[model samples]
Target: MHEMSIAEGILDVALDTLRQHDASVIHSVQLDLGLMSGVEPDSLLFCWEAVTKGTAAEGSRIEINTIPIEGKCLDCDKTFPVENYKFICPYCDSHFVQTIGGRELQVTSMDID
Candidate 1:
Protein backbone atom coordinates (compact mmCIF):
# COMPACT_ATOMS: atom_id res chain seq x y z
CA MET A 1 0.00 0.00 0.00
CA HIS A 2 1.31 3.44 0.91
CA GLU A 3 4.07 1.77 2.80
CA MET A 4 5.56 0.73 -0.51
CA SER A 5 5.77 4.34 -1.58
CA ILE A 6 7.21 5.32 1.75
CA ALA A 7 9.79 2.59 1.48
CA GLU A 8 10.70 3.71 -2.01
CA GLY A 9 11.19 7.27 -0.78
CA ILE A 10 13.41 6.01 2.00
CA LEU A 11 15.50 4.09 -0.46
CA ASP A 12 15.79 7.14 -2.63
CA VAL A 13 17.14 9.14 0.27
CA ALA A 14 19.56 6.40 1.22
CA LEU A 15 20.83 6.10 -2.34
CA ASP A 16 21.23 9.84 -2.60
CA THR A 17 23.20 9.85 0.61
CA LEU A 18 25.35 6.98 -0.62
CA ARG A 19 26.19 8.84 -3.77
CA GLN A 20 26.90 12.08 -1.92
CA HIS A 21 29.32 10.37 0.44
CA ASP A 22 30.69 8.05 -2.24
CA ALA A 23 29.87 5.03 -0.15
CA SER A 24 29.71 1.48 -1.44
CA VAL A 25 26.68 0.35 0.55
CA ILE A 26 24.18 1.48 3.11
CA HIS A 27 24.48 -0.40 6.35
CA SER A 28 21.43 1.03 8.05
CA VAL A 29 18.79 3.73 7.91
CA GLN A 30 17.50 5.32 11.08
CA LEU A 31 14.03 6.76 11.40
CA ASP A 32 12.02 8.52 14.05
CA LEU A 33 8.48 7.11 14.12
CA GLY A 34 5.95 8.67 16.42
CA LEU A 35 2.86 7.01 17.80
CA MET A 36 0.48 9.16 15.77
CA SER A 37 2.48 9.10 12.52
CA GLY A 38 -0.05 6.61 11.05
CA VAL A 39 2.76 4.52 9.54
CA GLU A 40 2.77 0.79 10.14
CA PRO A 41 6.19 -0.47 11.08
CA ASP A 42 5.60 -4.07 10.03
CA SER A 43 4.23 -3.10 6.64
CA LEU A 44 6.99 -0.55 6.18
CA LEU A 45 9.61 -3.19 6.96
CA PHE A 46 8.11 -5.66 4.51
CA CYS A 47 7.95 -3.05 1.80
CA TRP A 48 11.47 -1.94 2.57
CA GLU A 49 12.80 -5.45 2.04
CA ALA A 50 10.89 -5.82 -1.18
CA VAL A 51 11.92 -2.46 -2.61
CA THR A 52 15.60 -2.69 -1.71
CA LYS A 53 16.15 -5.80 -3.79
CA GLY A 54 19.26 -5.55 -6.00
CA THR A 55 19.96 -2.01 -4.85
CA ALA A 56 22.83 -0.50 -2.91
CA ALA A 57 20.68 -0.71 0.23
CA GLU A 58 19.56 -4.26 -0.49
CA GLY A 59 20.37 -5.67 2.94
CA SER A 60 20.45 -2.48 4.90
CA ARG A 61 18.74 -2.37 8.28
CA ILE A 62 15.89 -0.01 9.06
CA GLU A 63 16.08 1.26 12.60
CA ILE A 64 12.86 2.81 13.84
CA ASN A 65 12.64 4.69 17.12
CA THR A 66 9.08 4.79 18.34
CA ILE A 67 8.05 8.01 20.09
CA PRO A 68 5.10 8.16 22.42
CA ILE A 69 2.40 10.78 22.34
CA GLU A 70 3.11 13.50 24.85
CA GLY A 71 1.10 16.50 25.80
CA LYS A 72 1.65 19.62 27.83
CA CYS A 73 -1.11 21.00 29.98
CA LEU A 74 -1.51 24.74 29.62
CA ASP A 75 -3.53 25.07 32.79
CA CYS A 76 -1.44 22.97 35.12
CA ASP A 77 1.85 23.57 33.37
CA LYS A 78 2.50 19.86 33.46
CA THR A 79 3.56 17.47 30.74
CA PHE A 80 2.31 13.92 30.42
CA PRO A 81 1.54 11.14 27.99
CA VAL A 82 -1.63 11.38 26.00
CA GLU A 83 -3.44 8.11 26.53
CA ASN A 84 -6.36 6.60 24.58
CA TYR A 85 -6.30 9.56 22.18
CA LYS A 86 -7.68 11.82 24.85
CA PHE A 87 -6.46 15.39 24.65
CA ILE A 88 -7.50 16.18 28.19
CA CYS A 89 -4.75 17.04 30.60
CA PRO A 90 -4.19 14.50 33.30
CA TYR A 91 -2.94 16.99 35.85
CA CYS A 92 -5.75 19.53 35.75
CA ASP A 93 -8.43 17.84 33.67
CA SER A 94 -8.13 20.73 31.25
CA HIS A 95 -9.03 20.50 27.60
CA PHE A 96 -6.39 23.08 26.66
CA VAL A 97 -3.65 20.50 26.38
CA GLN A 98 -1.17 20.98 23.60
CA THR A 99 0.61 18.12 21.95
CA ILE A 100 4.31 18.33 22.55
CA GLY A 101 5.61 15.25 20.78
CA GLY A 102 4.63 12.29 18.61
CA ARG A 103 3.14 12.60 15.11
CA GLU A 104 6.61 12.33 13.60
CA LEU A 105 7.80 10.50 10.50
CA GLN A 106 11.30 11.44 9.47
CA VAL A 107 14.55 9.88 8.40
CA THR A 108 17.17 10.68 11.02
CA SER A 109 20.38 9.19 9.72
CA MET A 110 22.06 6.54 7.59
CA ASP A 111 25.06 4.32 8.06
CA ILE A 112 27.18 3.77 5.00
CA ASP A 113 30.25 1.87 4.15
Candidate 2:
Protein backbone atom coordinates (compact mmCIF):
# COMPACT_ATOMS: atom_id res chain seq x y z
CA MET A 1 0.00 0.00 0.00
CA HIS A 2 1.03 3.60 -0.39
CA GLU A 3 0.80 3.94 3.37
CA MET A 4 4.17 2.25 3.53
CA SER A 5 5.74 5.12 1.64
CA ILE A 6 3.82 7.61 3.73
CA ALA A 7 5.03 5.95 6.87
CA GLU A 8 8.57 5.95 5.60
CA GLY A 9 8.30 9.64 4.90
CA ILE A 10 7.03 10.30 8.39
CA LEU A 11 9.79 8.23 9.93
CA ASP A 12 12.35 10.08 7.89
CA VAL A 13 11.05 13.40 9.10
CA ALA A 14 10.86 12.20 12.69
CA LEU A 15 14.39 10.89 12.57
CA ASP A 16 15.64 14.11 11.07
CA THR A 17 13.92 16.11 13.77
CA LEU A 18 15.32 13.88 16.46
CA ARG A 19 18.82 14.30 15.11
CA GLN A 20 18.42 18.04 14.89
CA HIS A 21 17.25 18.23 18.48
CA ASP A 22 19.84 15.70 19.62
CA ALA A 23 17.08 13.62 21.14
CA SER A 24 17.41 9.92 21.69
CA VAL A 25 13.83 8.87 22.20
CA ILE A 26 10.50 9.82 20.80
CA HIS A 27 7.52 9.55 23.10
CA SER A 28 4.83 10.40 20.59
CA VAL A 29 4.15 11.96 17.25
CA GLN A 30 1.12 14.18 16.72
CA LEU A 31 -0.45 14.70 13.35
CA ASP A 32 -3.35 16.58 11.83
CA LEU A 33 -4.98 14.20 9.37
CA GLY A 34 -7.93 15.40 7.39
CA LEU A 35 -10.80 13.18 6.33
CA MET A 36 -10.13 13.97 2.68
CA SER A 37 -6.39 13.42 2.79
CA GLY A 38 -6.86 9.99 1.16
CA VAL A 39 -4.57 8.34 3.65
CA GLU A 40 -5.96 5.51 5.75
CA PRO A 41 -5.01 5.80 9.41
CA ASP A 42 -4.96 2.08 10.15
CA SER A 43 -2.77 1.29 7.20
CA LEU A 44 -0.42 4.11 8.01
CA LEU A 45 -0.18 2.89 11.59
CA PHE A 46 0.64 -0.61 10.46
CA CYS A 47 3.34 0.64 8.15
CA TRP A 48 4.75 2.85 10.86
CA GLU A 49 5.09 -0.10 13.22
CA ALA A 50 7.02 -1.95 10.57
CA VAL A 51 9.26 0.90 9.48
CA THR A 52 10.21 2.24 12.91
CA LYS A 53 11.63 -0.96 14.29
CA GLY A 54 14.97 -0.46 16.17
CA THR A 55 14.78 3.25 15.54
CA ALA A 56 14.44 6.19 17.85
CA ALA A 57 10.72 6.33 17.22
CA GLU A 58 10.15 2.66 17.85
CA GLY A 59 7.22 2.05 20.16
CA SER A 60 6.37 5.70 19.92
CA ARG A 61 2.68 6.51 20.05
CA ILE A 62 1.02 8.14 17.08
CA GLU A 63 -1.65 10.68 17.93
CA ILE A 64 -3.87 11.72 15.07
CA ASN A 65 -6.33 14.59 15.13
CA THR A 66 -8.98 14.12 12.50
CA ILE A 67 -10.16 17.19 10.67
CA PRO A 68 -13.68 17.23 9.32
CA ILE A 69 -14.50 18.45 5.86
CA GLU A 70 -15.86 22.01 5.75
CA GLY A 71 -17.05 23.93 2.76
CA LYS A 72 -18.47 27.30 1.85
CA CYS A 73 -21.33 27.75 -0.53
CA LEU A 74 -20.56 30.20 -3.28
CA ASP A 75 -24.14 31.06 -4.08
CA CYS A 76 -25.33 31.74 -0.55
CA ASP A 77 -22.02 32.19 1.29
CA LYS A 78 -23.12 29.64 3.87
CA THR A 79 -20.39 27.65 5.57
CA PHE A 80 -21.22 24.15 6.68
CA PRO A 81 -19.74 20.76 7.38
CA VAL A 82 -19.73 18.39 4.43
CA GLU A 83 -21.16 14.91 4.78
CA ASN A 84 -20.76 11.78 2.64
CA TYR A 85 -18.81 13.54 -0.11
CA LYS A 86 -21.73 15.82 -0.84
CA PHE A 87 -20.64 19.37 -1.55
CA ILE A 88 -24.04 20.97 -1.73
CA CYS A 89 -24.99 23.86 0.46
CA PRO A 90 -27.30 22.91 3.30
CA TYR A 91 -29.18 26.15 3.65
CA CYS A 92 -29.75 27.25 0.06
CA ASP A 93 -29.29 23.88 -1.67
CA SER A 94 -26.64 25.24 -3.93
CA HIS A 95 -24.19 22.94 -5.69
CA PHE A 96 -21.56 25.65 -6.11
CA VAL A 97 -19.45 25.06 -3.04
CA GLN A 98 -15.80 25.67 -2.37
CA THR A 99 -13.84 23.58 0.05
CA ILE A 100 -12.56 25.69 2.91
CA GLY A 101 -10.63 23.07 4.90
CA GLY A 102 -10.10 19.38 5.70
CA ARG A 103 -7.36 18.48 3.21
CA GLU A 104 -4.45 18.65 5.60
CA LEU A 105 -1.86 15.95 6.25
CA GLN A 106 0.91 17.33 8.38
CA VAL A 107 2.95 16.51 11.39
CA THR A 108 2.17 19.00 14.12
CA SER A 109 4.50 18.05 16.94
CA MET A 110 6.55 15.34 18.55
CA ASP A 111 7.01 14.49 22.20
CA ILE A 112 10.66 13.76 22.83
CA ASP A 113 12.46 12.32 25.76
Candidate 3:
Protein backbone atom coordinates (compact mmCIF):
# COMPACT_ATOMS: atom_id res chain seq x y z
CA MET A 1 0.00 0.00 0.00
CA HIS A 2 0.98 3.62 -0.40
CA GLU A 3 0.84 4.02 3.34
CA MET A 4 4.22 2.34 3.54
CA SER A 5 5.75 5.09 1.48
CA ILE A 6 3.86 7.67 3.47
CA ALA A 7 5.17 6.19 6.68
CA GLU A 8 8.70 6.29 5.33
CA GLY A 9 8.24 9.94 4.43
CA ILE A 10 7.04 10.69 7.95
CA LEU A 11 9.99 8.90 9.47
CA ASP A 12 12.32 10.90 7.27
CA VAL A 13 10.80 14.14 8.51
CA ALA A 14 10.86 13.01 12.12
CA LEU A 15 14.50 12.01 11.87
CA ASP A 16 15.40 15.27 10.18
CA THR A 17 13.67 17.22 12.90
CA LEU A 18 15.32 15.15 15.63
CA ARG A 19 18.73 15.91 14.18
CA GLN A 20 17.92 19.60 13.98
CA HIS A 21 16.90 19.72 17.64
CA ASP A 22 19.60 17.26 18.82
CA ALA A 23 16.96 14.99 20.37
CA SER A 24 17.60 11.40 21.32
CA VAL A 25 14.05 10.07 21.02
CA ILE A 26 10.73 10.93 19.50
CA HIS A 27 7.68 10.69 21.70
CA SER A 28 4.88 11.30 19.24
CA VAL A 29 3.83 12.67 15.85
CA GLN A 30 0.70 14.69 15.20
CA LEU A 31 -0.97 14.73 11.82
CA ASP A 32 -3.84 16.66 10.32
CA LEU A 33 -5.58 14.08 8.12
CA GLY A 34 -8.77 15.14 6.39
CA LEU A 35 -11.77 13.01 5.58
CA MET A 36 -11.34 13.48 1.83
CA SER A 37 -7.63 12.76 1.89
CA GLY A 38 -8.37 9.07 1.02
CA VAL A 39 -5.71 7.80 3.44
CA GLU A 40 -6.69 5.00 5.79
CA PRO A 41 -5.60 5.59 9.38
CA ASP A 42 -5.42 1.95 10.38
CA SER A 43 -3.34 1.00 7.36
CA LEU A 44 -1.05 3.94 7.89
CA LEU A 45 -0.56 2.97 11.52
CA PHE A 46 0.28 -0.60 10.57
CA CYS A 47 2.80 0.57 8.02
CA TRP A 48 4.25 3.00 10.54
CA GLU A 49 4.98 0.16 12.93
CA ALA A 50 6.76 -1.73 10.21
CA VAL A 51 8.81 1.20 8.94
CA THR A 52 9.93 2.46 12.35
CA LYS A 53 11.61 -0.75 13.48
CA GLY A 54 15.15 -0.23 14.82
CA THR A 55 14.79 3.50 14.35
CA ALA A 56 14.61 6.35 16.84
CA ALA A 57 10.90 6.74 16.09
CA GLU A 58 10.10 3.18 17.00
CA GLY A 59 7.17 2.83 19.43
CA SER A 60 6.25 6.47 19.01
CA ARG A 61 2.59 7.48 19.07
CA ILE A 62 0.82 8.76 15.98
CA GLU A 63 -2.01 11.19 16.59
CA ILE A 64 -4.35 11.72 13.66
CA ASN A 65 -6.70 14.64 13.80
CA THR A 66 -9.62 14.05 11.47
CA ILE A 67 -10.75 17.07 9.51
CA PRO A 68 -14.29 17.20 8.18
CA ILE A 69 -15.15 17.99 4.59
CA GLU A 70 -16.41 21.53 4.28
CA GLY A 71 -17.76 23.45 1.31
CA LYS A 72 -19.14 26.86 0.43
CA CYS A 73 -22.04 27.65 -1.84
CA LEU A 74 -21.47 30.35 -4.40
CA ASP A 75 -25.14 31.13 -4.80
CA CYS A 76 -26.07 31.59 -1.14
CA ASP A 77 -22.65 32.40 0.27
CA LYS A 78 -23.21 29.79 2.95
CA THR A 79 -20.66 27.37 4.26
CA PHE A 80 -21.55 23.92 5.56
CA PRO A 81 -20.23 20.41 5.98
CA VAL A 82 -20.47 18.28 2.85
CA GLU A 83 -22.46 15.30 3.99
CA ASN A 84 -22.11 11.97 2.14
CA TYR A 85 -19.96 13.62 -0.56
CA LYS A 86 -22.81 15.73 -1.80
CA PHE A 87 -21.72 18.91 -3.52
CA ILE A 88 -25.18 20.46 -3.52
CA CYS A 89 -25.70 23.55 -1.41
CA PRO A 90 -28.06 23.07 1.49
CA TYR A 91 -29.28 26.63 1.64
CA CYS A 92 -30.02 27.28 -1.99
CA ASP A 93 -29.79 23.86 -3.62
CA SER A 94 -27.19 25.26 -5.93
CA HIS A 95 -24.68 23.16 -7.84
CA PHE A 96 -22.10 25.93 -7.89
CA VAL A 97 -20.21 25.01 -4.75
CA GLN A 98 -16.55 25.27 -3.93
CA THR A 99 -14.78 22.96 -1.57
CA ILE A 100 -13.08 25.00 1.13
CA GLY A 101 -11.25 22.31 3.06
CA GLY A 102 -10.80 18.60 3.88
CA ARG A 103 -7.97 17.47 1.61
CA GLU A 104 -5.20 17.97 4.19
CA LEU A 105 -2.46 15.40 4.68
CA GLN A 106 0.45 16.76 6.63
CA VAL A 107 2.40 16.40 9.84
CA THR A 108 1.65 19.30 12.13
CA SER A 109 3.86 18.64 15.17
CA MET A 110 6.23 16.23 16.86
CA ASP A 111 7.03 15.50 20.47
CA ILE A 112 10.70 14.69 20.91
CA ASP A 113 12.76 13.85 23.91
Candidate 4:
Protein backbone atom coordinates (compact mmCIF):
# COMPACT_ATOMS: atom_id res chain seq x y z
CA MET A 1 0.00 0.00 0.00
CA HIS A 2 0.97 3.67 -0.25
CA GLU A 3 1.24 3.83 3.51
CA MET A 4 4.36 1.63 3.26
CA SER A 5 5.96 4.14 0.98
CA ILE A 6 4.97 6.98 3.25
CA ALA A 7 6.45 5.14 6.20
CA GLU A 8 9.66 4.60 4.27
CA GLY A 9 9.87 8.29 3.45
CA ILE A 10 9.28 9.22 7.07
CA LEU A 11 12.01 6.85 8.20
CA ASP A 12 14.35 8.30 5.61
CA VAL A 13 13.80 11.79 6.93
CA ALA A 14 14.19 10.67 10.52
CA LEU A 15 17.42 8.85 9.71
CA ASP A 16 18.76 11.82 7.80
CA THR A 17 17.92 14.14 10.67
CA LEU A 18 19.54 11.81 13.16
CA ARG A 19 22.74 11.79 11.14
CA GLN A 20 22.67 15.53 10.62
CA HIS A 21 22.35 16.11 14.34
CA ASP A 22 24.89 13.41 15.23
CA ALA A 23 22.30 11.48 17.13
CA SER A 24 22.49 7.71 17.19
CA VAL A 25 19.09 6.84 18.54
CA ILE A 26 15.55 7.95 18.01
CA HIS A 27 13.05 7.77 20.86
CA SER A 28 9.98 8.89 19.00
CA VAL A 29 8.77 10.52 15.82
CA GLN A 30 5.90 12.97 16.00
CA LEU A 31 3.65 13.82 13.10
CA ASP A 32 0.83 16.29 12.53
CA LEU A 33 -1.84 14.51 10.50
CA GLY A 34 -4.94 16.32 9.38
CA LEU A 35 -8.35 14.75 8.85
CA MET A 36 -8.39 15.78 5.21
CA SER A 37 -4.82 14.74 4.51
CA GLY A 38 -5.98 11.41 2.95
CA VAL A 39 -3.39 9.46 4.86
CA GLU A 40 -4.78 6.61 6.90
CA PRO A 41 -3.37 6.55 10.44
CA ASP A 42 -4.05 2.87 10.99
CA SER A 43 -2.32 1.90 7.77
CA LEU A 44 0.63 4.12 8.58
CA LEU A 45 0.96 2.56 12.01
CA PHE A 46 0.84 -0.93 10.53
CA CYS A 47 3.58 -0.09 8.06
CA TRP A 48 5.79 1.73 10.55
CA GLU A 49 6.95 -1.41 12.30
CA ALA A 50 7.99 -3.06 9.05
CA VAL A 51 9.72 0.02 7.70
CA THR A 52 11.69 0.69 10.90
CA LYS A 53 12.95 -2.82 11.30
CA GLY A 54 16.76 -2.95 11.76
CA THR A 55 17.02 0.81 11.35
CA ALA A 56 18.25 3.39 13.83
CA ALA A 57 14.63 4.33 14.51
CA GLU A 58 13.71 0.76 15.38
CA GLY A 59 11.60 0.43 18.49
CA SER A 60 10.87 4.15 18.41
CA ARG A 61 7.40 5.41 19.15
CA ILE A 62 5.26 6.89 16.40
CA GLU A 63 3.08 9.71 17.65
CA ILE A 64 0.45 11.24 15.42
CA ASN A 65 -1.54 14.35 16.31
CA THR A 66 -4.83 14.41 14.45
CA ILE A 67 -6.12 17.79 13.30
CA PRO A 68 -9.78 18.45 12.75
CA ILE A 69 -11.07 20.05 9.60
CA GLU A 70 -12.00 23.73 9.86
CA GLY A 71 -13.53 25.87 7.17
CA LYS A 72 -14.85 29.37 6.59
CA CYS A 73 -18.05 30.15 4.82
CA LEU A 74 -17.74 32.81 2.16
CA ASP A 75 -21.39 33.85 2.37
CA CYS A 76 -21.64 34.27 6.13
CA ASP A 77 -17.96 34.68 7.01
CA LYS A 78 -18.48 32.11 9.71
CA THR A 79 -15.74 29.67 10.61
CA PHE A 80 -16.74 26.25 11.83
CA PRO A 81 -15.62 22.66 12.07
CA VAL A 82 -16.34 20.49 9.09
CA GLU A 83 -18.21 17.25 9.65
CA ASN A 84 -18.34 14.20 7.38
CA TYR A 85 -16.22 16.02 4.83
CA LYS A 86 -19.13 18.26 4.00
CA PHE A 87 -18.15 21.73 2.87
CA ILE A 88 -21.53 23.26 3.47
CA CYS A 89 -21.60 26.31 5.69
CA PRO A 90 -23.41 25.64 8.91
CA TYR A 91 -24.74 29.12 9.49
CA CYS A 92 -25.51 30.20 5.95
CA ASP A 93 -26.08 26.80 4.35
CA SER A 94 -23.81 27.88 1.53
CA HIS A 95 -21.63 25.58 -0.54
CA PHE A 96 -19.04 28.29 -1.02
CA VAL A 97 -16.69 27.44 1.78
CA GLN A 98 -12.95 27.69 1.97
CA THR A 99 -10.86 25.27 3.89
CA ILE A 100 -8.73 26.86 6.58
CA GLY A 101 -7.08 23.81 8.06
CA GLY A 102 -6.98 19.97 8.17
CA ARG A 103 -4.89 19.34 5.08
CA GLU A 104 -1.54 18.90 6.78
CA LEU A 105 0.68 15.83 6.73
CA GLN A 106 4.10 16.62 8.11
CA VAL A 107 6.66 15.51 10.61
CA THR A 108 6.61 17.96 13.48
CA SER A 109 9.29 16.73 15.88
CA MET A 110 11.51 13.85 16.90
CA ASP A 111 12.93 12.72 20.22
CA ILE A 112 16.51 11.78 19.62
CA ASP A 113 19.57 10.90 21.59
Clashes of each: 0, 0, 0, 0
Q: How accurate is candidate 3 locally (lDDT)?
A: 0.94
Q: Could you give candidate 1's per-residue lDDT for residues 20-45 as a string of tens digits? A: 99898998999999998889999999
Per-residue accuracy of model 4 over 1-113 as CA lDDT, tens digit each: 99899899999999999999999999999999999888999999989989998999889988999999999999999999999999999898999999999988889999999
Query: Candidate 2 residues 1-113, lDDT tens each?
Result: 99899888888889899999999998889999999989999988888899999999999988899999999999999899999989999999999999988898889999987
Can you list the residue pairs that collide in candidate 4? none
TM-score, per-candidate, Cα-based: 0.89, 0.92, 0.93, 0.91
Order the numbered candidates by TM-score, best leading.
3, 2, 4, 1
Question: How many Å off is the CA of 11 in candidate 1?
Answer: 1.1
**Model 1 stretches astray by more than 4 angstroms:** 74-77
What TM-score number comes out for model 4? 0.91
Query: What Cα-based lDDT does every candidate model obtain?
Result: 0.92, 0.91, 0.94, 0.94
Q: After superposing candidate 4 on the true structure, give the runs of residues whose Cα lies further than 4 Å from its correct spot.
A: none
The TM-score of candidate 1 is 0.89
Residue 79 displacement (Å), model 2? 2.1
